[model samples]
Target: MQLINYQMQRFWQYGGFNPDLYLFIPLSQTRYVTRGYNQVSQTWSPVLKKHSNVSEALFRVRATKAQSTLSRAQRKRNLKDAFSLSHCIQGKNIAIIDDVITTGSTMDAAAQTCLDAGAAKVWAFATSLTPLLGK
Candidate 1:
């Protein structure tokens, strides 16, 4: 928690805070049930509670296999049309938060879903970035 707080503070210092909304990547019902919580949400909840702009505005409408085993192209295909917006984010700037980013296909799908729901712009933040093989 201390590390997350430090990172959040650094993000604020760098002017990466203050998005209109903070949207955590939604886990599928199956995954959520299996895991009992979304780790990203769990980690960000305290800071987000202070800001009061945290929202579960997006949800997964379909399930996909664990991304760790997938190739980049397969990851993109797996996430296609997997998310749905629960409310209008019209003209709002959104920041999608996640624990880690690998190929970024998941974030791309989430951003596209937000755009489809009328978000003005979307930015993504992750605690870690996993380098792709041979990169």
Candidate 2:
């Protein structure tokens, strides 16, 4: 968590990614029930709360196959309309945080959802990025 916090701080300080609100990618109900907590939210909430508002801006509409287990096409298909906005974000700049990014389908879907809901701009941040492998 310390390393992630450092990187996130650098992203804001050096990368100049200031946002009106911070949003963490929500876990599906099924996954949340099994895991007991959304690690991404748990880890970053306190850190972000001090500087910016942290919001659960979206919810998973349905569960899909794990991204790591899917091909690129399948990854895109799995998240289609999978998230629903939970609150108003009109004209707000948002930062969406996720634990890991692979093909970026998840972030794209979330950002698109926010955009469709009238958010001014959306930026994505992740603790790690997975190298793409043969689908």
Candidate 3:
């Protein structure tokens, strides 16, 4: 928790991004039920609570196979049409947060959904990135 808060502070200080809205990738209902919590929200949201723009508007529409168990191509397919926006954000700049980025398919899908909903721009921030799976 300390590490995530520190990283978020650094980004706010130096990342030069001031988004109109900040959205975190959400876990599906099934996963949240099994885990009893959404780790990403728990880790990232507290640091962002002072910012009024942080929102829970983006949501997973259905459960999919875990990305850790999939190949890059499969990862992309797994997240297709998996996300939706709950509000209209036309001409707004959005920032998406996640715990870790692996294949980037999850972020891509979420960003695409935001764009399709009329967000003028979208940025992705992750605490960590694993090497490309097939690299």
Output the TM-score of candidate 2: 0.90
Q: For every model shown, what is its TM-score relative to the native structure?
A: 0.90, 0.90, 0.90
**lDDT of candidate 1 over 14-39, digit per residue (tens):** 97556888999989999999999999
Per-residue lDDT over 1-135 for candidate 2, one digit per residue giving the tens place of the 0 to 100 score: 788778878987898787888889999999999999998888777678677478787889999788889888898999999998888999999999998999999999999999999999999988789977988
Order the numbered candidates by TM-score, best leading: 2, 1, 3
Clashes of 3: 0
Superposed model 2: Cα runs more than 4 Å off: none
Per-residue error (Å), model 3, residue 66: 0.5
Better of 2 and 3 by lDDT: 3
lDDT of each: 0.89, 0.88, 0.90
- Worst 10-residue lDDT window for candidate 1 reads 10-19
